[model samples]
Target: MKRLPNFVQLKEVGPRDGLQNEKKWISTADKIAWINMLSESGVKEIEFTSFVNPKMIPALSDAREVGKQIKREPGVLYSALVPNMKGLEFALDAGIDAASVFMSASETHNQKNINKTIDATYPVLDKVIREAKQAGKLVTGYVSTVFDCPYEGKINPDQVLRVCENLFASGVDDLSLGDTIGTAVPTQVEQLLEVLMKHYPKEKLILHFHDTRGMAIANIMTAMHYGINRFDSTVGGLGGCPYAPGAAGNVATNDVLYLLHGLGIETGIEEKKIQDAGLFIQSKLGKILPSRSLAYFANAQ
Candidate 1:
């Protein structure tokens, strides 16, 4: 392989994106402890929680409280998903460093997931991103299902660019593409990355993938092959989108870091610390870790 990017931005999504869809409900204290541990693990950015309706995603209902209680480390960017103006306000008032405003590239998935047409969502996201910008809070744009959708499979590359253009025009600080259903392979990832690179600089994009079909890490390397260095990962592989059916588990934090480490990519994420953090949350959720890297370390000890 040719040379990959020099530095990678690894964002820990275990607390918000990871734990939200799990069957068991974790306590607020445990959530705080998990976030703090990951912060100390040298991850510079983290999607901490979502500010959605509690009745809908009860998993993230305590987002405001989580923000208030958790300590923010210097140089660490902690963010939450804000579906609209309401969520954005809560995140900003709670002292969140940044917030994500998102929609899907697939129309059917967008409707099924958020109950809004993709066109309708653009306006909402525009309002939220503009508000966050005025508040001096960093904002990220999410384009889910850029690779493919379970409901509407085989999304086109142009669709990804159109959504990204909407997000960038809305004044988003960055754009993150999600293979929400884990149906993406290296070829599709390369195709989407090509379009994104044509319209977006490498610094402006982050890749989010689930391991439903056992291809998440491989897809990450594919993105890296195309010079994508920023990615979303959940510790112990503890993430799935509630909206993406059959999509479970994100790429593990240590797994990606270990790969980057071997490739001499500077990710700034500590392996042992992330491992300990994963063990802590796994014990709370009371389930076996889905990450092979975490499992290997646990067995070794």
Candidate 2:
């Protein structure tokens, strides 16, 4: 009997989203080690690396090598960030199967983060999407600050839909709407999703949320109620928004898995193994994790 689609797609963005803005630079070996452990824990897709200027983001200085070294298992995906064609080349050379491209829905954040206006960034992002599609690469498009922006307070759903139009026209396979600043609540999530679903397919859209205000899991539950099945999360909540300063990381992997399993939704992620990997990675970084729920399991001796 083929069950109805009642599962969630958990894309582990820890290697890229979680570590990109860390104060201390984690070595390439440690990154590779962490991702390898995550791959074994049944995360369907992992953002394994990024292709960007090392001088700009020293955290992922070894993007090329990290993508090359991570052990890829069957039924699991290894994705990287290709900021441009140059990035696409490096990721292709590293044998990456999928790549994610980023842009912001708010004009203020677009210029602040990428130093370009919305009009200017749109064409460039379109070019990246076109080229990646032509290269037979699975392209995932990310629109950051869908809920709110530190500089541009209260994002409009119309702005989000406009950006989605450009991205879909450019041939993106998956679209991820990000709550980059963690300013979203359950009501806000449901409101934006209502508008987003009218324009985009629910299957290709993913939610990338931050836990700065501690409502990340609640927002996820609200999204579930609205029929959203895919979500982006980090291990042990080990990340923050580079654009949104002082913001917390995405919802924790173990906590989300626990919630999903308790609700009888199949996520295919092993709860204990993921918590264990979170423990291993957090120890290597030597910092207290932000996930209150993960802390209980990680701290229990």
Candidate 3:
């Protein structure tokens, strides 16, 4: 008998991860408006933007202004990706409720994505994590490329364990494991979780999967059966890793909700509202998004 949780926790990363890779610049006002729309959509947490250097991610260059201006609801936890202490400062100044630090599980991918070796990257993350905690903000550590790396293929679960251990020890409240290049299948997810669950509680682990090969939903089903309930998703499957070549968008939040709700698993999120928010962002981008559920809901209504 497979064990699936009665409820699931979904973190909305569409505002940050979904938009970071796009070439067209979404206006600051539009970003703010879209986030405000999502705030009413019943998601508990939202990674609204990143505090990276403006030159690095010009799409989210208005992180500070967007963070400051969004109509924050009382129950929503507003979070941002903080790459360093400097970024942490900016995020803290913008009053983010949480700070997310990140790195890749593959050493080569870590160096390529973060521009620093895995060992060297820890101290920087440590400082950011410590300061964010001291400021009374929650910290989430994201480990990218946990399953496979674009440059270094087929990542060993042990490598991911090492990275996760250090991040958890450094005081992250939880770790979001990434299938960065979207190469993970159900067996691989099960294998990796078998290794990881021994050292870390399932509650402390959140799965972040990209739907590059149309396997994210399958992998997610495996995770759910293994008693994992938290996941990171983009609103309309809008995302790609600039550092991970050929990586596709994240698993769509709309689709995930459809799956969970259809299974009688509770997410406490309205699928129609989520699809509407997806449609809003899709229109702003002037492009059709990749979320099948969003497309279906849009057409149905």
Assess every candidate by TM-score.
0.96, 0.95, 0.97
Report lDDT (CA) for all predictions.
Answer: 0.86, 0.85, 0.92
Rank all candidate structures by their TM-score, best first, as comma-separated numbers.
Answer: 3, 1, 2
Q: List the residue pairs that clash in candidate 3.
A: none
Best by TM-score: 3
- Cα lDDT tens digits for candidate 1, 91-171: 988888888887999999999989999999988888889889999999988889998887888999998899988889989
Candidate no. 3 TM-score: 0.97
Any runs in candidate 1 off by more than 4 Å, and if so which? 240-248
Instruction: Evaluate residue 251 in candidate 1 and report its C-alpha lDDT on the 0 to 100 scale.
Output: 85
lDDT of 1: 0.86
Q: In what order do the candidates fall by lDDT, top score first?
A: 3, 1, 2
Native-vs-model 2 lDDT? 0.85
Our tally of clashes for model 1 stands at 0
RMSD to native, candidate 2: 2.8
Candidate 2 lDDT, 1-301, residue by residue in tens:
2232488989999888888887677888888888999999988999987787777878898998898888888999888887888888888888888889889999999899889998898788788888877878899999999989999899999999898888888888989999998879999998898898887778989999889889999989888887889999999887865454445688888788888898899988888888888888778877767776678986685
